[model samples]
Target: MLSFRMLAPALIALALCGTGPASAQSFTDTQRGDIEVIVRNYLIAHPEVLEEAMNELSKRQAAAEAAKHEAAITQNADTIFNSPRGVTLGNKDGDVTFVEFFDYNCGYCKRAMTDMLDLMKSDPKLKVVLKEFPVLSQGSIEAAQVAVAARMQDASGKKYLDFHQKLLGGRGQADKARALAAAKDAGFDMARIEKDMASPEAKATIEENFKLAESMGMNGTPSYVIGKQVVVGAIGLDGLKEKISAARCGKATC
Candidate 1:
């Protein structure tokens, strides 16, 4: 448990050296030691400077990370937003597109599914894309394969959404067997779904999803893309609405 007071000296040392002590050739050991003492004394006298320095450092780091995310989004825009592999929901020809990368075994994703559905129901002009990001377990991967296979059997994706709701909203771990049962409940032909599950198309779609997720630095489920902004976590329905509004009208809400 390092406190701000304890960390101030190290931060000050970095500020003076402009790099780690090992890489710093400009200052001698004696000079560096003297500078550290001076910085420590000064910071002790004026603690606000330490706070200001920390704030600036945080701002710069956030700006750099945001730039990286924006660049990644630009590079993968086509595959991310318009890929045929992604499951399409809501208005197919909507003005604003929202994308979600989710795992069936994710508890947060199950809770967030309602937010997605509610958004679809409330906003007719919003396009929703569901990416199968099954990093939780083998069962998650199996469920995603079946979901993608269900998508293939019926291109309309009507049954796919139903199957999604059934499995994600169901109790306990969602495995291949449970996923197949959901598909059956959604009126999908079990024989065809089983065959399609083992097809290369299903494998390819999941592979592409993993690739896209990796490219975008997504390491978890329930992450979202609303226009150019990459939003992580469930973030609730209000948070989603604000992002959607921001995308459409340049404001948090219309």
Candidate 2:
């Protein structure tokens, strides 16, 4: 009676016959059917084998995804880390650059906003870049356009960050009107923002963000590019710090 674990290797080895119709010639139909029957019965008796196999598969997939992200980060390092299109904050000359793509209308981005602020507050050596990635709706695009316009007048990112907090943290839908309200409260020159909003810069900035995000496989708000790692979603503050540590010292904690 062969155990599930014992049959696992055989199942994995049988994968060789799946390359193509020509390559599958190595295993005759009868032989393949016998192996499949044995493996299927074992898997039924011990379902943990399926779990173990899936876990291994997931590990491989994650590793492959991370490698792809690293490659994309390397290829676009200059634009991703140093492009003037993105609003730079925190230590500009820090050891690690953290780039975030967010849509103002996203609820997760609102919550993740606190985590970003906390990271900047806690880590003096962390540099932050904010890019507008408005994939949510027409209203989101409108808000992002306003945000990019606000970034134009505020080179220091003080007013822009304040404006960002207000738009993302505020209640209800984030359209041009709501964004305009937030910009006013942030004390931006309203006339200047309106003028900039209709300029090519605002449109180009958002377009560039979309291109960069698409290249890196980022399709959501609050996706982060920290130290060559493309982290999707808000993994919380501790997860962020660990990524920073890994980037800084080549480990999750340093």
Candidate 3:
């Protein structure tokens, strides 16, 4: 492990050179060495400056990423919130839309399902959309295909939600077999599911979800787009509520 004494000179030099190659080129070897020594000594004596600089860097990076998310959200607003490729639940005409991209086999999504359900029950004005993002496994792809087929046979989303909860909340690996079982239990037409799962719409729906997720720079299950912001992980129910409230009425609670 390099100590601060070992790293200070390089850090200071990098900071100075970060401005431009011209400024670094203007300095002679001796002058640059002298500058590094001075800055290194000052930084060592006031170590808090390093922490402050790093905090500032973090803030700037977060702001840049948020700006990127906002840009993507604006560009894809119509498809993201209202595309028929996704399953829409909750208040259809709600002011706030909570969109989730999830793989059936994801553990975090299994846990997050409760949050989605709770929100639907508690907040009548929040629109929730579920998109199949089957990136975890081949089994996940198979399960998603069945799910898409289920949705095709049930436009009301009632049976689809039941199938979703059963397969996602189940204790085992989610594959075509388990998904079919869930659909059967949810009272879906198995023959229709088997036939529909092979349809172009099933493939197209999953393809559309992957495209949407890629556009938003989403790479994991349970990623969300609430209002203008992209939330990249399962932030728990309370954390999710804050994001929802921020979108709903410009506050953490509304």
Candidate 4:
């Protein structure tokens, strides 16, 4: 016969195996066989509690990583917009600064251009910084060159913004010929604009914009850095307005 102590462990295992309820428990030979099979199958299927624990732990780790990314963006308010290549529009000494990274070929950027113009017109104390991030195609680079060349013609911020709007707003690609034609339509000197497009300063400025965009993790064409938030994609006019308003109170540089 099994000792009482040894039988106690077997009885407890049998109870866990559903041989009978712990309270007033009893088992027949058939019940004992079924209980043994149940226990064996369970042990085989769920052999490692450690694996389940690890899976739960991995889920927690991924959540923590996402939170950390959000926090990092929140803390980057000053560094993103205050960089050297950042442009200022509206009020040079405005209470709010909205920085946008855009490509000449991005349709969403063209759509947002109208909103930007409207906002500038509405708010004199709003400063807008435009960063040319030409990531779309080879044609985008040509468009950026012409736009930067137009800026070199001593045009006002309004002209730059207008040209930006038109170039992005148009159909077809913005190749060199198309960009120069757009410049002419914007009242820029076609001959001088083409010559100046190849200047070292223009190249340097575009390179700087590229570097800044890369630093801020701006892989896409239409990304905005408002206050401490790095908003990716074309979130429309209202979304931009809200971000700018929030930036005014929290952190203006970024």
Q: Answer with 1 or 4, whichever has the higher TM-score.
A: 1
Note each model's CA RMSD in angstroms: 3.3, 4.2, 2.5, 12.2
Model 2, span 1-254: residue lDDT tens: 44656765568466555577576667787877777777678679988877887789899999999999999999999999999999999999999998999998889999999999999999999999999999999999999989999999989999999999989999999999999999999999999999999899999998899999999999898999999899989888999999999999999888
Residue 42 C-alpha lDDT in model 3: 82
> Stretches of candidate 1 above 4 Å error?
1-32
lDDT order of candidates, top first:
3, 2, 1, 4
Encode model 1's per-residue lDDT on 86-161: one tens digit a residue.
9898899999999999999999999899999999999999999999999999999999999988888877888889
- Model 3 lDDT on a 0 to 1 scale: 0.92
lDDT of residue 133 for candidate 4: 81
Query: Model 3 misses residue 42 by how many Å?
Result: 0.6
lDDT of 3 at 104: 92
Better of 2 and 4 by TM-score: 2
What's model 3's lDDT at 244? 95
TM-score of each model, in listed order = 0.89, 0.87, 0.92, 0.66
Query: What TM-score quantifies how close candidate 3 is to the native fold?
Result: 0.92
Q: For model 4, what is the error of residue 14's alpha carbon versus the real structure, in angstroms, after optimal superposition? A: 29
C-alpha lDDT of candidate 1 relative to the true structure: 0.89
Tens-digit lDDT track for model 4 on 116-210? 88889987888778877889999999988888887777535666666766687888888788888778777888888978889997798789777
lDDT of 3 at 3: 65
